[model samples]
Target: MLAFAAGFIVRPFGSLVFGRLGDMSGRKHTFLITIVLMGLPTFIVGLLPSYATIGMAAPIALIALRLLQGLAVGGEYGGAVTYVAEYSTPSNRGFNTSWIQTTGTGGLLLSLFVILGVRTLTGEEQFASWGWRIPFLFSIALLGVSMWIRLKLKESPEFEKMKVQGTRSKSPLRDTFGNRRNAMTVLLSLLGCTAGLGVVAYTSQFYVQFFLLQTLKVDGRIANEVLAIALVLGLPFYVFFGWLSDRIGRKPVILTGCLLAAVTYFPIYKSIAHYANPQLEHAHTMAPVTVYAPPGECSLQFNPVGTASFTRSCDSAKAALARNAVPYSTVAQPPGTVASIHIGEQVISAVDGKGLSRSQFAAQTAAFDAQVAHALASSGYPATAVPADVNRPMLVLLITILIVYLTMVYSPAAAWLVELFPPQIRYTATSLPYNIGNGWFGGFLPATAFAMVAATGDIYYGLWYPVVVASCTFVIGLVFLPETRFAAAAKISSARASTN
Candidate 1:
């Protein structure tokens, strides 16, 4: 936890530093540096020793590595967005900027796939102890690949034009924040776009996992697997939505998504509820069977019961019987029932047939088992031999809705943010607000939401945090955010006309 907090704390500073460097020097250079920095720490995290080996020092090292990661990420997004936006024509800005957005989803999906592959190969027990570390260590190779791509990327035309014109800001920070107008623009832009993007993005991904584990009581492995599948399925939508914004305009696309999210939030949650609950309306229509034991001591036994034993004492018989999924009519047993069942310390009593023949009772038990199986299959619960609760499927469905909203809003934001400022201060100006909104607001989502739930004692209340924030940003976007689809194109056309 300390590591996570420390990393977040350093992110804004990293953004400030890298943003300035990108604006002053070049976006491509800044991007390569941040990628290398981010990847190396991730690799080191995989190699770190556990508490048992190094005691308190282990956690300390982990925290330091997290801080490094935070710093690197803080700068990475801003540079990548600016680099892409600068090269793109204004008419296709949304579509081009979306490539940067898509990278984030791609990165997450890649991580999920790696984790899933490792788990499948190593199995659960071995994976927990050491197999989990392989993915993080493997990122060193990814970093090298990114570095190669970044090296090949050209400098932005806008920045080049600014340099030739001798119009680059002497002090980018002063120009960015020293002027009240620019500062207000930055703030309004973030409030209008990035804030909501941050919430939606985190809610869709991180909060879903928490909801599955804590609220819906889903098996962690199953929940993760479902989420991984959903994310991969939805990956194309990120770029598709980004392209749509180019045709329809950024504000409309974003506003439509936000409005749809607002209208559908409750309904989506309800759908999940219906799907997850076996007793709910859409649950599999299975006939229920009731099993009853006769008015005597009854023992429940499993087939292929290895080394199974029951005790002579009444309490022991009840305790042993309760562990099995036997449906008995009453809680109490008849007198002398306990003493009659002890055979070599293993109890064997006359299995009851409550108002039914032996064969009829057996049929009822089979029906109950079939119902349980149907419920488990419909719920997508883990296929363990033991019966488990079926609530996570609903939570997973809710997460899918959230992811849709997230991708819709976030995919276009890179273009919107990049277009808001001139090339001279674009890197620095965009990075500061983007990191704070995403790294600070979005990244802290799980921690903040969990803390709120812990304090309030209601899981649903934490959702209000994202809902309220997103709504406010949606309103701001409707009122304040401009359509930037044509801004760069207009500028280029004007430049060409002047030259002609």
Candidate 2:
């Protein structure tokens, strides 16, 4: 929570500094620097020691890293978008700028893959303890690669043309905000475009995670896996829809995403809720079971007085018990496996996976009926259980639609925003609005939406926040946003001609 909040707090400042620098110097250089900065901090985070070892310093270091990350990211988007937009032809500005937006989805997908690969390799316990850091550490390699690519790219043609003509604004901030017309244009552009993009981005990506885990009670692992898959599947649509906007016009694509989101939010949430119910029921019915014995054998040890005994090989299970906040023993077993199982606890059970008939299994189990019954009851599995009715496909479909809406709204803004101001103040002007909308509205979405559900006892109410915000944005776009698909170069050209 603290890390996420830090990202929001620091983003606007990053935008200001980087945005100004990008406008003053060159977009390529500024973007490359921000990318390197972002990657290095994330890499450092992967290497940092845990709280158990570092004590109070762990959280402090974590916060510091997150702050750096926020700053780096705040600058990165504006720089990248400006670079793309300045280089792109006005006719294809939306399509070209959309690549900047696609990179964000790519980053998310990359993070997801790293997390999943590490988890799959290490298993849950190990992943929690040490494996979680690998992905962050891996960012060093990614940064190096990204830097290489960025270095090879040229400065934007538009900014170069302005520089050649000596037409760049001396004071970008003053010119941008000092003029009422430009200031209002910036305000209206943010209200119309980025605001909606921010909400859709968070609602689709972040909120879906919350809705699945908190509201529907889906397992975190499953929810993340599902989301990762959906994100990958939906990624191409970001560029595709962006390109479509170039042909059809930006307003239609963005408004379409907003309208679709508004219409689908409730149904998507309901579908997730409905699917997750059965999974939760199944989890309750067929609870997990663990068994413990001596190091090499399944032999049980009894105390001399037959009241308590010590077991040495059960260290793993004991560790598991400790992790779950359950109390257990390295020393003591009450007669059977029944006492071994506890609520919110794990018990080690010895079972052969070899094939056996149902009746044969039942008859065989009768031999240890008391112990088996105790284990079953303790593990929370009833003798008679109903089958679960989980609709995984339906859930996947809904999440896909949600990601599509997010990408549609977000992908076009990168170019659209950069075009709103002159090259000189483009960074500062665009960055402020982008960060506020993305940082405050987008960042707080999950928490705020959850709070709404908590207060109202209805999950769908939270959807209203994004829906209403995007709806207003749709209206704003229709009223205030100009067709900037061909304006950036034109502005520079006009400035140059005036000077000449």
* TM agreement with the true structure for every prediction: 0.75, 0.75
Q: Runs in model 1 with CA error above 4 Å?
A: 277-398
lDDT of 2 by residue, 291-401 (tens): 433334222221112233222224323322322322122334443332233333643343321365656545544443444455545664433221244456776778888
List per-prediction Cα lDDT, in the order shown: 0.67, 0.70
Displacement of the residue 309 alpha carbon in candidate 1, Å: 45
Model 2 bad stretches (over 4 Å): 278-388, 486-500
How many clashes does each candidate structure show, in the order listed?
0, 6
Error of 1 at 368 (Å): 34
Query: Candidate 1 lDDT, tens digit per residue, 1-500?
Result: 56666776788889888888888887777888898888998999999999999999998888788888888888988888887877777677788887778777687778778888999999999999999999988888888888888788888787787879988887888899988978887998778877777877777777766665555544567777778777776777788888988887777777667666666665665455344433422221232112222234434322121234322233232332222211112334456543212212222333233466657656644554354434444443323322144555455556666777877988888888887887788888888877777877777777666544433323444577677778888898888877777765677799999999
Provide the lDDT at 376 for model 2: 45
